[model samples]
Target: MMDMQTQPVRSQSRPVVEHGFVTESMTDTCAIVANLEHCTNTAVALQSHYAQGFLSSRHKHGRGQISYCQSGMMLVMTDEGTIIVPPGHFIWIPPNMYHQAQAQDGMCMLSIYVENGLWPDLPGNSEVFHASDLFECLMQRMIEIEEKGAFSSSTFDAIVTLIRDEIGLASRLDMSMPMPRDRRLARICNAILREPTVLRGKDELARIGNVSHRTMTRLFQTELKMTYSEWCQQALILNALARLAAGDPVTTVAMDLGYVSPSAFSAMFRRRVGCSPKEFAKQY
Candidate 1:
């Protein structure tokens, strides 16, 4: 039996607060999140730093959140999919959505929490978007205000409005990978995620899932609405994004992902990501 459980396990530790910001070093983050959700402020901003390989236990917040990755990459995993937030990008998580986060190569992030019903158009689903220069500046201002405890400042209100408008107009990135519900298919997906460079054959993957090739194909298409090969290609692209953002050399990342040559990998990355690996790395 595969015995692979795909669902996120909830943490039972009590929550703790420290330094006016929630720190993973304290305790379970649930308590701080709960307190923030009920704060009277229209929006609250907090900064957090995580070391490489840091993973937060599965949790949810009552307020919608905008998480901006300032210096590294983050992977926000929800039941629907896993969204990659590289530097210069942010992910908006809807209120009360269950999710877990992982730091890729360590990260410095700023999280903005908006009270419920503040923006009627706030998306009900999580989305990743490239942060514009102006948006980035506005977020910095918000952080300054947060540090000063100036929620009632007229300047704070003005910046919040601009931030909301920016978010509404920002370009969304297709960086998420939808997960399958079936345990057999989930097992195959997990294996690919663990070692994306392997390039396993379809029959081999099917065997690993304890299914025939055709059944495996159908499961992917039916559950994820994407063909198995297409899904794998996306998986590879996401992995490449994280690696490149982590300051990995283009050639090194290419070789690690099993590409025959840097040129070949660069070509595919350009086609899917709309930029060469070198260009993408430079942006970070």
Candidate 2:
């Protein structure tokens, strides 16, 4: 992904609405929208956030949101699942759907929040849509409009309608992670999250959860719907992707992430991400 710290800034127009807040320059690769108030259906606010590390908060927007990164990668988590947004790939979040997004590398994002009732055909709540050619262009246009602060007669409505239609027709891609609420299982989850690439075996997690191996297995399958090892793999892959995006070298990342060797990590990367680490790095 291109560095946000060096991306061209939007025009000098200041925000007219007191309700919308913007973080003009977040980093060399990202921006942030702290919050926006009273910004309802007809109008949506666009902002950006860039970070080199993870963002831990799970969010539920009052309206729908689309986060398209100009650079780097984003992993968005929701109750339903987690979606990986690579550069040129974005995620569409329906209204009221809880989600948390973490930066894999340093990321530059353009996020738009729409009113709840604007589009009916689209999923009522969370749906992750792959970024299509038209979809990507529309997002770029939105940036141009917002930066110029030039709202014409049909500007807002036209843009919203196009986005709504795109949402209606856009393919729903699998880019989500399911979250379990069980506190016992959650303990194991927390441990894995803290050291995703290093943790090993169900016994380790069972010890931390203070449960038998059998119990831990049952809880992991029943609550998380995946084995402990599988969950750990998923977590490690996500962490690896983030680290890779942040411009880390493969050999160093492999070592730091607990791989036995760079080749071992490369194989895992290819298996999970459908590409070698070097190939994936080129997309950013």
Error of 2 at 284 (Å): 3.6
Could you give candidate 2's per-residue lDDT for residues 174-244 as a string of tens digits?
44445568888778777777677674777877898898999988987898788777777777776777677
The list of candidate 2 runs beyond 4 A from truth reads: 1-37, 53-59, 75-84, 98-105, 124-127, 165-173, 249-276
How much is the lDDT of residue 253 in candidate 1? 88
TM-score for predicted model 2 compared with the true structure: 0.72
- Deviation in Å, model 1, residue 173 alpha carbon: 0.5
Alpha-carbon TM-score of each model against the true structure: 0.85, 0.72
- The per-model lDDT (C-alpha) reads 0.77, 0.65
Task: For residue 158, give model 2's deviation from the true position in Å.
Answer: 3.4
Reference-based lDDT, residue 210, model 2 = 91
For every candidate structure, what is the RMSD over all alpha carbons to the true structure, in angstroms? 4.4, 6.2
